[model samples]
Every structure is written in structure tokens, then in C-alpha cells.
Target: MEINPAVTFKHDRSIMYAKRPKVLIVGAGLAGLTLGMLLHKADIPFEIYERAQEVKPLGSAMYFNSTTANFFKQCGIYEEFLAIGKYVSSIQVFNEVRGHEFSMDFEGQEAEFGANGYIVARPVMYDLLLRQIPRERIHLGKKVLTMDQGGNGVLLRFSDASEAEGDILVGADGAYSAVRQGLYAKLKKAKRLPSSDDLPLPFSTVCLVGQTRPLTAEEFSDIGLEQCQFRRTIGMEKMYGWATFTTAQNTVAYNVIQFLTDETSKQNDAFRNSEWGPEAAMAMCEQVKDFPIVSGDDKELTLGDLFEWSDKNHISKVMLEEKVFKTWYDCRTVLIGDACHKFSPSGGVGATNAMHDAIVLANRINGLPFHPIAEEIENAFREYKAERVEWVQKAFDSSKAFKTMTGQSFASKATRFVSKHMPAWLFQRIQAQTCANRPQVAFLPLHNDTGRIKPAPQPSLSVRAPVEAETPVAATTATATTTTTEVV
Candidate 1:
């Protein structure tokens, strides 16, 4: 069915969506949620489907700086985030024996970037993103078993024997995304998929992460401080590493990473292939219980205390894989975040990069013409990739470097020595480059860049006039047979 373009106005923003393609997102993750919020703001029709019956707070905590702060302001949740986030002054790194090695100070970030660094519990951040959209739009327990897209439209078959069709399909799902699998299967059969994309994701690190229950000042003195207590401990002779952060909720979030050598990675093939759940998490907890935690007030603590205080059901153990797929989209199907690129958690930019993917993709999608065809949709996908691929590669490389620096290999020790002794001027130069690309929603009124250091150019930005009234203007420039189908 041929449909005319639609101009939907909400508040002060007006966006012209070419037929307003019904977006079917296959994951309600950070990337998916960020995309949904932008589409919602533009009055574009979209729905998110998650395989989990209920979303769990699996990861530990996430740090946010200028990279994503503007998007939070665009979503009108910046103030809320500030309220829940614990400001981070610096991240202190120590040796296995509690001797301070080095520190990454973020003291002047507020003045330089217009936003201070902050760390919040992953669950808290997830909840903040969840509340932006209407509850009815998110369909939980809808596991997508298969996906197919033709020249005209896209379709999804869920595990419950139900099906959904839309003009566009987004694979925002995680590393093992079913949507990606389906797309790759088709590409492989047609002899179009790249050989590297066909390989399984390789990994050298496994992580266990969780957030403890709220504690009193007596229980954890660091919780009383205004600044986030971020600490990292690198084992000297052991393969294990650990970190902890004090959050605004009077809770401590911790992560334990075990670097696996070539032999060890090969040895854990069975465990790596098995599904991860509470049982896997509990078993890992027992293994890393003895790892020491750096705390203020000279108090002694260990990973076991945090694990004990945390709900066992919330802790998660998963492999940290780093890969950027060569193929991101085909026809009406595309991907975002982990579905396309998976970065190690060492850089603390995995979630930030995921949301960045969503922002750029949404901007490109909003620029589609009044009556877009398969070619046009693919063009938008290509443009999105073109604009984001460079940044994604940079993030992947940065994350990998950090992962190597924290490993127990001899090369890791050398990298740490060089990093610890790096000149302050050179270090700041690298830091400046890393924080230079802060993208925002283009169709909306752009957030004023108040940072001293300007952000990198955003090629996907599409500035449009803001609507003046409450009623939305609908475009009716097509034939009488034109119809709009809303996804239920």
C-alpha cells in the first residue's frame, strides 16, 4: 500500500516521517529504549519486543559524562539523572596489595564539558529510560524466533506463535541477537555475508557484576560521600581484577573480571556456550569471593560482602566479547548497539556507544522522504552506518586497549607501566579526543553546546521548524487508497 508522508507535531518539535515506517525493535535494551524515546518524541510509530518476561537489573553500574548527557537533556530526564547519579571525581587504580598505582581525575569535567562525570546503578538507569515511554508499547516475553524482510515490508515471528509486521525491522537485541542471526543466515545463503561476520564472537574475559542492597554509613562509610567512590584493583600474579563504585542509592556496585588466556578460553568452551543464569552467577561468586575491595576509612572489605548483600538473582556472569560486524543491514532490516558492534566493558563506553548508535540511526530514519521504498530505507541504513562506523571503530579499539591494560599478560604489565607514567599533557590530549563526539537528536531543537570543548560535527542532524500548537498536522498528499497501519 502506498502512503503519503506524515508530519507529526508534539510539544515544540515537528518531524516529517516518510510514511512513518512502523519500527519493530527487537530489544528493550539501552539502545532500543533510547531509539524508542526519539521516535516517540517525533510521533513516529515504533514498538519494542523483549525476550525476557521481566527485565532484570543484571549489570553493575554505568558511568556517564558529556558523551550522553545532552541526550538526557533532550529527553528531559537530565535533572532526574543528576538526582540519582553519584558525581565521580576520579577513578583510583591500585595494585593487588592495596598500593595506589595511578588515578584518572575527572575534576574539571563540569567546567570543560558542561557536564560532570557520574555513576549510577545500571538498574536505576534502566528504570529511568523505561519510564520515558508508555508502558503499553513495550511487549515483554515476545521472543523473536525468526525474522524476514521483503522489498515491501518486514515481518517477525515470536516464540508464542504470534507474528508482527512492520515497514522497518531493527535488531537492537544483544550480542546473540536472533534478528542478526536471521539476517546473517539470509546473507550467507545468498553468498553476500562477509567471512569475518560469519565467525563466532571471540572472547578473552569473563565478568561477574552486581549491585548490593542499600547500606548504612556504618556498613559502608563511602556511601556517605558526595563523590562516587570508584576504585579498581589489578592483581599482580592472579588473573582476576575487580572494581567498585559507591552509588547515590547508598548501594555499592562491583564487578570482577577474570582474564582468560588462549588455553583457558579454549578450555571453557562448554561453559561459554551454556546459557548464563543465577546458577552460573552463584558458582562464579564462590570463585571470586576472596578478591579484595578498596574502601575508604581504612576498612577491610572483599567481593564476597557485596555478593552476599546483593540479591543473587540480580548478579550476572557473561563473556566480554569485542567485535564490529561488517554487515549491519539488508533491505528493510537493520541493527543497532550490540547487534552490530559489541565492545568490552573495560572502557565504560559500551552502553554510551549503544545509545549513540540509536541516536544516529533515528536521525537518519527521520530524514526519509515522503514515500520511501526499499532502496530509500537501505540508503538511510547505509548513511547511519557511514556516520557511525568511524566512531564505533574508535570505541572498539579504545575498549580493547583498556582490556589489555588490565589483563595479567606481560604485555598488559608493560601497557600499565606506560599508562601510569604517561605525560599529563599527552594524557589530556587523548582524553579530549575521546570526549569530543557528543551527538544529540537532530530533528528536535538542538541542545545548546555549553561545553568549553566543542563536540565533533554531526552529519546526520536534520533541523526542522518547531510546531506552535497542540494539534498535529497530518500530511495527505497521496491517493485515496493510501493507508496507515498501526502496530498493535
Candidate 2:
């Protein structure tokens, strides 16, 4: 495979040689795993610490837009991923009470952007990423207790009374990040912490997500073919909405979001800090048990029906928090993904943003000289933050706006009116403009020798060729070589 020269950085193979810094990453989620993959490609030593005993199917499902699809292609996992997901041709919006409907076609996106949006179960995606990296590098059940950084390096203390040191540390630990909290605490004691990092944006919406067993042909037909389409149904009020998507795995994933409009601090606290478990999730489902899941062809499937079809153990409920923090790094410590900027999941771009962070940050670090000093590492962190902040803020705002426009508010009504009345071509044009501005992985090779990292050979698995791959290659041999290299 030829590498694209445009994305490669030129550097002497051997100059000022020093031992490459080891990175200690907290959280083995998407962001952490991606960073590890990039570092592995660059021959940088790193380790990942995950609090969970093992990686499991925890979340409902995630969507990958063109931007994310391109990144996966670069990583050599696009074909495998494409085989697991269902390509979303269009998105349909309906109002149960108002009897309004609209559709946005995404089929043209494939021609313009190389791929359309695809949806897959969260676990399937996680497994694909996990398979690319060596299992020894990941440490499970390792909860990060605290971290301290000094002139030499960063020291991490784990809950199991173990300690480790690394040249740099990254906190990819999700919204309630312990690394972010630890860094903030240290800065606050020194009286240098910013006010914005003191608290996260308040959340008033609660969500329940679950996946149903594979639907039989008869069951699927009863709900209409629209059930197989990406669909969102708005409620009569501004505070409620639900979305459903059926994947290639034959499972149906659904999300129910209800916004609290009471405007009371108690109500906010109750929902935000609410304990979520199987019982709680089922209880919430009972509240709207009769709510329509999909209504068409004189047939209606309710939330209760979906819940009844899902395993109780797979259901989860939680609050949706949205915010972009003012600070992302301090000294040898930095943050990525939901640890810094969290989205409302309305636009389905949060995971994509996380993957983007991994690429940008890795590229910045890869640009540094071999065995860089602390100053050089800090400079890389600064550059990474500078490149990402604006884009992240934009995505954050867009997601919030999307959530609002799908509700029962005046804005939602206006949005619905335009969507229902607009021509399909106009919608496609608007979507094209949005995709044009979407952020892509930069400073990385895409086509030639410098573009991607090939992984070590693994056992054979069945996977189809990516839509973009003209000549199909065996899955086992196709992803066997590392495509990118770090200057040493």
C-alpha cells in the first residue's frame, strides 16, 4: 500500500536520541484506546488503566458520520466496522400528537463525502478497537485515585495501592473525570484554577436507553418498514422525545429523553444525582409505558413493548450533561473526550469528537522530536488544545441546538415547519454545507505509506471490503502492516 506523502512529517531517523516518553492513560474507552493505537503506531510506549473489570456492552449504540468513517478508514478498521453496522440512508422525523412528518435523505452523502452515517452497537465498535491493540497494554480494574506531576514526570496512585510513573498522563475518564478533578484541586490550592472548571453545566434532562432482541420478520413488518429506518418521534410537549434505529445485527436500539421544565433546583438535583439501575430504568419506562414507539399503518408500538422485549440487565438511565470546559491541560496532565467537552447526544457527535481529539493530539505529539523534553511535550499539548477548542465549542453548540429544535418549544415547531415544507434538495444542500465544515483528522497520512498504521497479524475473521476499497483484500492480510511511523 502506498502512503500519502502530504500527511507525513519529515525528520531525521536518528537525531538527539533520547528514550521516548511513556504515557499513562486513564480510562480504556474509545478515546483512550484510539490514543494508544496512534502511540503504538509511532512506537511510543504507553499503558491504559480502566476502572471496569472488563469491557462490556454498556452503552446503547453510536452513529458514525462521514468524518468518523474517514478516520476509521485511516485506522484500517473501516471495512470490519462497515460489516457490523447499518448504513443510514435517511433520517425520518415524526410528531405523534401533531401528525406531522419529514425526511432528510443522506444517500447523496456517500458520493460527496465517501461515506454516509452508520450506526452500530456500542460493544461491537469497542471490540473492533480492542482487537487492534495488544491486550497486555490494557490494565483493567485499575481505578485512578490521584495524580501528581513534577519536574521529572507524572505519578499516578491507584485504588489498589499501586503506583506508576510516566512522562505524561491523559484523563479520558468520561464526564466525572477523576484526573480533571485532581488537576483542578491542585490548581485551586495554588490559587490558579479558573472558575469555569469549578462545576459542569447543569443538566435537566433524563434519558433511558435499551436494545431489544432481534426482531422476527413478522414482528418487524407489524411496525412498518419505518422501524428499520432512523426515526425520531416528538411528543406533544417540548420536554419529551424518543429515537429508534435498527442495526444490521437485527437489534433495535432506542432512547427516551425527557426534559424537566419545572426550573427548580431540587428538581434538577433529583434528576442529575438520581441513582440509575435496572429497577430505576424499568420504573421510568413504566411512566411512559403506553407512549408510542413507532406509529404508522394504523399500528402502534409503545415503549412498554420495547422494554418488554429487552433484557432488563441491558437497560440504563442517566442524565445528559452538556459543557465545554475552559481548561483542558495543566503541566504534564491533559484531558480529552467527555472529560473536557461533553455533548447532549442530540446530534450523535460526542463519540466522533472524542475520536477527533485522539487524532489531533496524537499528530501534535508525533510532530515532536524523538525523546522530547518537558517543554516540547507541553508545547504539543498547547497546540493540541488550540486546534481543538474552537471546533469542540461549535459541536457543543450545535448539539444543544439540535436537542432544542427536536422538542415541543417554538423553535422546534419552526424547525418542524421548515423540515416538513422544504424540498429534499434544499435539505441535502444544507446537510452538504454542514458536512463541509465538519472537522477531520489532520496531519496524518490517508492513502500512501505515511497515512495509516498497520497492525500485527491476527486470526482470520469474516469482513467485507469497504465501499471505498476498489479491490477487495482478505481481512486478515489487509490490516497486517503498520502504515505510519514516528521519527526516532
Evaluate model 2: give its TM-score: 0.83
Off by over 4 Å in 2: 1-17, 97-100, 222-228, 263-268, 271-275, 295-298, 422-426, 437-445, 448-488
Q: Write the per-residue lDDT of candidate 2 for residues 1-488, one digit (tens) a residue.
A: 22121333433324434556789999999999988987887667899999889775766778886766666777788889888887787777877653548776677666665567888888778888888889999999999887888656788889999988888899998888889989999888988888877865667677888888888646654233532467788898546898888877777788888877776335546555423767778787888777776633444677787888888888888778888988898767899998999899887888888987887777666554444445556666776776677668878887887788678878878877876788877876666544553333344445322212221121111111122222212321223211111110
Summarize candidate 1's per-residue lDDT along 78-125 as a digit string, tens digits. Answer: 999999999998889998878899987777776677788899999999
Q: Quote each prediction's TM-score.
A: 0.90, 0.83
Best candidate according to TM-score: 1
TM-score of decoy 1: 0.90
What candidate 1 gets wrong by more than 4 Å, as runs, is 1-18, 273-275, 463-488
Say what the RMSD of model 1 is.
6.7
lDDT, candidates in the order shown:
0.83, 0.72
Task: Give the range where candidate 1 is weakest over 10 consecutive residues by summed lDDT.
Answer: 479-488
